[model samples]
Target: MRREQVLVFDADDTLWENNVVFERVIAQFLGWLDHPALGLPERRAVLDEIQAANAVTHGYGSGMLIRSFADCATRLRGRPVTAAETAEIAALAAVLIDHQVELVPGAADTLARLGVRHRLLLLTKGDAEEQRRKIDASGLAPYFQALEIVPEKDDAAYRRLITAYGLDPAESWMIGNSPKSDILPARRAGMNAVFIPHAHTWVLEHGEVDASDPGVLHLGALTELVDHF
Candidate 1:
């Protein structure tokens, strides 16, 4: 049980819910897409297909979702949609995108407790503006010394953080929700990982692993983080 130095945390599902809002927006889009001529199931199928394809290219974001909807609308309408129509679609997106930061239960308390001793850093991946907006609105920004908003959480991300912070991987811990993004990669980098599961995690964030490793740990809630160390 070597003493820990730096503790990095993921921002999205780790601190708050992200994909749940996406799911709500997708549902709203599906309802709007359905008409007398277009069946809901058929429209949903097309959306799913487009989203699957878009995941390969855009990864994840409101922009990608809106673009996919615009593309689908164009194919169905047989005519170019007006700017007004695009605005309507994007307006539906705004409801979720404009949402205030709703922290996961106990996130603030846990972070406050942990901030007392460890060097805390936020390591997350998402659109720069949106991620920053959420961080700012969450009122939790002050807890972290810095943030590393990356495109992907991989071995490279871990190496970069270690180098940037001048930290020993063995003495640093990565606390996050996604096993794919946080646990496996951190373990591979020889850092301890603490996984706090969120109910509505994105599918792409899933990855295979044995959580029994000394370097890997899982918790049910964010507050459990304080006890792990």
Candidate 2:
């Protein structure tokens, strides 16, 4: 019989086009600002700063992003934001929240194939409701034996998952795009990790990774995983 390995997958960027949607929405928000003094780069910097601040208090999701956009617009305009402007911002949030969850190439095929031989689990971090909505819409939900949406992805979180599922560190593997959240934490938890880098990774998610780590494996694409395992 094939070994019963516990395979954990990250939902965002790892399995679908997540950060790309956020980037597009940021562009739309900047267009709405239309500040002569603030160029695209400056506006992006301002938004990132505000978003980071809001993330600490409000956590992560479209709701936090919308609030940050409103705050940034108000700061740039040097005046109280009008009700109409707020309405437009709300519309933008709607578009972002309702955007279709597009799967990464080969994600579905790989998950389907792996499901037959391994215990598949989706480990994602974000707003609970938003993450659930995206997972429900992705159409890839059936393949996972469980779905975990957390406030943060850290070593402690991975340890809890390992304990909760009664998973053996030697037989468990975590696969994702973010080194800080997915790869490093899994390795720290004594589980193997597969790093599949994404082009549009969020700046906050970037971190220094030691390629020499024996427990970490790097793949150029999601399809490559099928051949590796």
Candidate 3:
């Protein structure tokens, strides 16, 4: 393998505990849903229904989580919930949103090390506003040469980044946690792919694969790539 010039990194779970926060908040709401007055089965039923119905639309976001909980509360109570109760539920999520940002273990040191030799860029997907907020709070922003927040990551996004940077995919590597969003598409674009597993990954991000993908590489964590370099 030739030395790569660009080291594109994914922002969310790759660098920090992202989806876990959402999962934790949702768990709290679920615990509330299991109140004796609500019944365990009924609570699960409501949550399952909401997720099934909203799976394609809202996906995962603060707004979707908030609305799903609000809808579930109304359904369980058989009437609209009071503003105070709604506020309380939303407050749990609010705290998560406002909480101090933290990087995954070794994230900063690894990035700082890699940034010295590679042209580092942060490529992430999701709500642009929220992503920016996380980036700002993370203090990982300065290490990257540039940052991008897109709705979808595909060949077009890859091409745009390459074009913008005047880079050759042959000499650039996409390093991220998601198989769907980072590895597979990047390989298809003729870019080398480095997969660094995270503790949490979304259901849709999983992809079927075999060992023949020469451009694809896997590491235990982001910091592990220092050895590869």
Highest TM-score against the true fold, candidate: 2
Q: Candidate 2 residues 127-157, lDDT tens each?
A: 9999999999889999999999999899999
Error of 3 at 153 (Å): 2.5
For residue 122, give model 1's deviation from the true position in Å.
Answer: 0.4
Q: In model 1, where is the ten-residue run with the lowest total lDDT? A: 1-10
Error of 1 at 31 (Å): 2.3
Weakest 10 consecutive residues, lDDT, candidate 3?
52-61
Which residue segments of model 2 deviate by more than 4 Å? none
Between the candidate structures 1 and 3, which one is better when assessed by TM-score?
Answer: 1
lDDT of 3 at 103: 89
Clashes of each: 0, 0, 0
lDDT (C-alpha) at residue 225 in model 3: 83
Q: Which digits, one per residue and each the tens of the lDDT, describe model 1 over residues 36-89?
A: 677877887677677668866876678878888887777677677689989989
Q: Could you tell me every candidate's TM-score relative to the true structure? A: 0.85, 0.94, 0.82
* Model 3 residue 148 CA deviation in Å: 0.6
Q: lDDT by residue for model 3 over 78-174, one digit each (tens)? A: 7897899788888878966686777888999998888887789999876688889999999999999899998678888888888888878888999
Computed on alpha carbons, the lDDT of every model, listed in order, comes to 0.82, 0.90, 0.80
